[model samples]
Target: MTTTTPAALRAAAERFGDGEAVADGSVRLSWHDLLTAAETVARALIAEGLAPEDRVALCAPNTHHWVAAVLGAQYAGCVAVPVNTRFTEPEMAEILTRSRARALFVVGTFLGVDRLARLQGFLDGVTVIRIPGEGDRPSPDVIEWDALGAVAERVPVEVARARADAVTPDQVSDILFTSGTTGRSKGAMTAHRQALGVAAAWVECGEVTSADRYLIVNPFFHSFGYKAGILAALLSGATMVPQAVFDLDRTLELVERERITVLPGPPTIYQTMLDRPGKRPSTLRLAVTGAAPVPVVLVERMRSELSFQTVLTAYGLTEAVVVTMCRPGDAPETVSRTSGRAVAGFEVRIAGDTREILVRGPNVMLGYLDDPEATAQAVDGDGWLHTGDVGVLDADGYLTITDRLKDMYVCGGFNVYPAEVEQVLARLPGVSECAVVGVPHERLGEVGRAHIILAPGTSLSTEDVLAHCAERLANYKIPRSVEFRTELPRNATGKILKRMLRDG
Candidate 1:
C-alpha cells in the first residue's frame, strides 16, 4: 500500500521485464532495461554529490531521456524539477533558481533553437549534464549523457532498489510549476503519495493497460504529460511513445505505425487530426480530451469517425494533477458535456455563490514551495484548495467548466463568461474556431473581444458575428469588436494564449 513512485516502478520492471516500456525516435527499451538505466542515472547523480531531497532540473523536450531523468531522480531520493523547454530564458531561470537545483540535465537544441546556449549565463556553477542530440559536440565542462550507465555499473542494483524502497510516501517526488498564464508560476510541492495516487487514478480512469501503446503528444514539462501521461503509462505497463513536438502528419504516422491505444491531450489536438482526416490506425481504443472546453461534436467525431472505443473528457490543474474523469461506461453525451465526477479519492464542491471550483483530496499538493503566503491564499483553513476555475455542477455531480474566475469580464456592468461566448461562436455559421478575451472599454470596465477563425472558403463580417451573438447572449454579453484571423494563438498544450491577445 506504500505509494512510493520508485518502488512501484521497480515492481513494474520485475513483472514486465522484457516487454517494451518506452520508445524514442529509433531507440526502444524493455521495462527491465528502462528501470536499470533510470537507476543508473540516479547513481551517476549521486556520485556527483546530489543529496536526498535535493532538486535536479531536467530541461528537455519529450524523449526517453526525460522520463529516465525523472525516474532516476526518484530512485536517488531527489526531487525532479522539469523545466518548460518552450519558456524564455528568464522563465526557465525562475524555475531553476526557485527550486534551487544543484544539477541540470538539458538538451542543446529544441525546436531549432539553441537552449543550452541561452542557459549558459544562468547555469553558472551548476553541475551540467548534456543530453547529446544530433550536431551536439562533446563538452569537457559538461558530463556526457552516456556516462550514466557506466556509473550505474559501479553501483549495485540492489543498493539502488534499497534506496528506492527506503523512500517514504511523504517524501517530495517532484516540484511542478504552473504555467504562468495569470501571473508568476508557483512551484507546487507534490509528494510521492500524491504523484503515485494521481497517476494510478489516471490509469484506471483513462483505461490504460500494458496492451496499450500510449502515444504521448503532450510535452513532458506539463502535468498532462508527466503525471497523467508518461507516469500513467508506466503504472499500467503501457508502452510510452513520446512526441517531442506535435506535428499533424508525424503524429498520424506514429499512431498508425505503432498502433497507439491510449491517446490524451487538449481539444485542439483532436481538432487538427479531425481537420486532416487521413489513414489512422484502428488500434486507438481510448481517447481522453481535456485542458480546454470539450465540444460535444468533437467527442462524437472521435468516437464515430476516429473509431475510438471510448472518448473521455476530464478537468484538473497543476495543483492536484487530476480531480474529475469520466468513467469508462459513462454516456457519450455526458462525457462530452461534463468534466465527469470527482476521481475516487478527491472531493469537489462549488464554493458559495461565486461557484469557483474547490477541491479537497490526497492528490492536492502539500503547498507552494517556499511561499507560505501564496499557499495560504490558495488553500483555505478547511484544507480545500480553491481552484480559481468557474464551473457549474450538474444534477449528477458532473462539472462543466465555464471560465476561469480571472478570465470573466464585465461588459457594460454585466457578467460574461468567455467560454459561454466562445461556445456560441463555435456553433455560428462559417466559424471554425474562436477565442474571447477581455479588453479595456471607455464606458465599461472591460468588454469582450472576439477573435474568430473562419472555416475554409467561408467569410463572416463583423456585423454578422455581432448579429449572431445578439440572439444567443444578452446585449451586454455581445462582443463589440470582431477580428477574423487564419488561426488563434495557442500554447504548446493547445490552450489559447489569451494573455497574448490581451497584450496584442
Candidate 2:
C-alpha cells in the first residue's frame, strides 16, 4: 500500500498477489497470474530485439490480451501506444506512422487482417504480431502472439522485480493519442509518475478502497479509462471488470450479478441504463461520469429516480488524467452543474476572456509525441495547460463549463456556443442524444444547426425540437435548423464528432 514509484503492476502483485485482478466475461486472472503474463510478454518483447524506449502499438479492443500487452510493453521499458480500435485503415496507418512504432500487436479478425495488409506499405520495417484467431495468416515475417509466449522464457522473478523497481516516475509510460475534433489527433506522452499521481489524487478525493468493485466500461485507449478506471482500481486493490463493448443490458446485468460497487462511464451510458427496465442494485455505492458533459436532468434522475447513493461528475483530458471531480458529499446541484473542484495536487483557473480554462499540476502530461511545437503551444512556459474549454468559477469555487473556445460560433454579433444549445436540446423529452455545430451563413458568417437522435419509439419534428430549444435558450443560441439521425457519429470514446456534422 506504500507504493511510491510508477510501477503500479509491481505494487499490485506484491500487495494483492492472489486476489482477483481482472475479469472479462468468462476470462479471469488473479493478480499473480496477471503479473506472470506481463513478465512473460516482457521477456518475449526483449527476445524479439525490442530495445528499451522502443514503441509498441496495441491495436485491439478492450480484451484481456490488450491489458497484457500494455503491461508487457511497460515491463520491458518500452512506450505503449494504444490505437483506437474503431479507426479506419488509413486512420490507423496515420497513427502508426506518427508514433513510429517498432512493432504492432493486432487482433486477429478479417478487419484487423485487412487493416494490417493496408498498413504494410506504411509499416515498412515494423514488425506485426497477430493475436491468434480466425483470420488471414500473416506472412512468415510476421509473428504470432501465442508463438512468442512459447519462445519467450519466463524472466527470473528477482530480475523482473528489480527492473520494475528501477522504473522512475518520470519515465514515459504511454503515448495516448487524443481524438481531435478539428484536426489530426495528437499523441499525449504520459509518464508513469504522472499517471500514478492522478490515481493517487483520485484516491484521496474519492476515498477508493480495496473492497470496491470497479466496472470499466470506457475503452482502454482513452486516458480516463486507463488512469481513472484501470490504474485507480489497481492502486486501490479493487477488482476490475472489463467489457469489450458497451451494451446497456449487459452493463446493468453485470452490476447486479457481480454486485459491482462502482460504475464509471460517460453520461450517455448512465442515461441508457436508466432507460432500461432493471432497477438499481442495493450494493451499488457510487456512479462516476466523465469524458463528456452531463446534463443536470440526468444527474437528478439518477439520484431521484434510480436512488443511487452517489452520482459524481468529472472533467479531464488526455493531457491531464483528471483535473476536476465532484465529490460525493458535494451539493447535488454542484455535482449536476459544475465539473466540481480541482482534484488534489492540481490547480484550475480561468484566464483572458474568463472563458479559457487553464490547468497546472504535476499530473500534467510531459508533452505531445514528436511534436515539440504543439506541446509548447498547449503548455505555456508558465506551466499552465491552456485547456481549450470555456468555463466560469463562481465566488463559492464551483466550476461551471460554458463551452469550448474553438466551438463557439459568432452569429449576428453574438457568440453561440454549441454546448449551451446542446444542453437545452438534451433536456427535451424523448431526445436521446444531440450535437450542435456551426454552419456557413452569408449574413452572420455562421449559423447554428442541431443534429439529434431520438429515443426508440419516440417521435419529434424539427419544429418541436426548435420550439423546445426556443423556450430554454436565447434566440441567437437556438438552432436555426434541426436534422434527425438514427445515431450520431462518435469517436472510439463515445464523444460526438461535431466537425462531421459541419462537414456533412
Per-candidate RMSD, Å: 10.7, 10.6
Candidate 2 lDDT over 28-74, as tens digits, reads: 88888888888877777776777777899988767677777888778
Worst 10 residues of 1 by lDDT: 408-417
Error of 2 at 120 (Å): 3.0
Question: If scored against the real structure, what TM-score would every candidate get?
Answer: 0.81, 0.78
- In order, candidate lDDTs are 0.82, 0.76
Please report the TM-score between candidate 2 and the true structure: 0.78
Q: Any runs in candidate 1 off by more than 4 Å, and if so which?
A: 153-158, 179-182, 408-504
Q: Relative to the unseen true structure, what is the C-alpha lDDT of residue 114 in candidate 2, on a scale of 0 to 100?
A: 56
- For model 1 the local lDDT of residue 389 reads 87
Tell me the deviation in Å of residue 315 in model 1.
0.4
Clashing pairs in 1: none
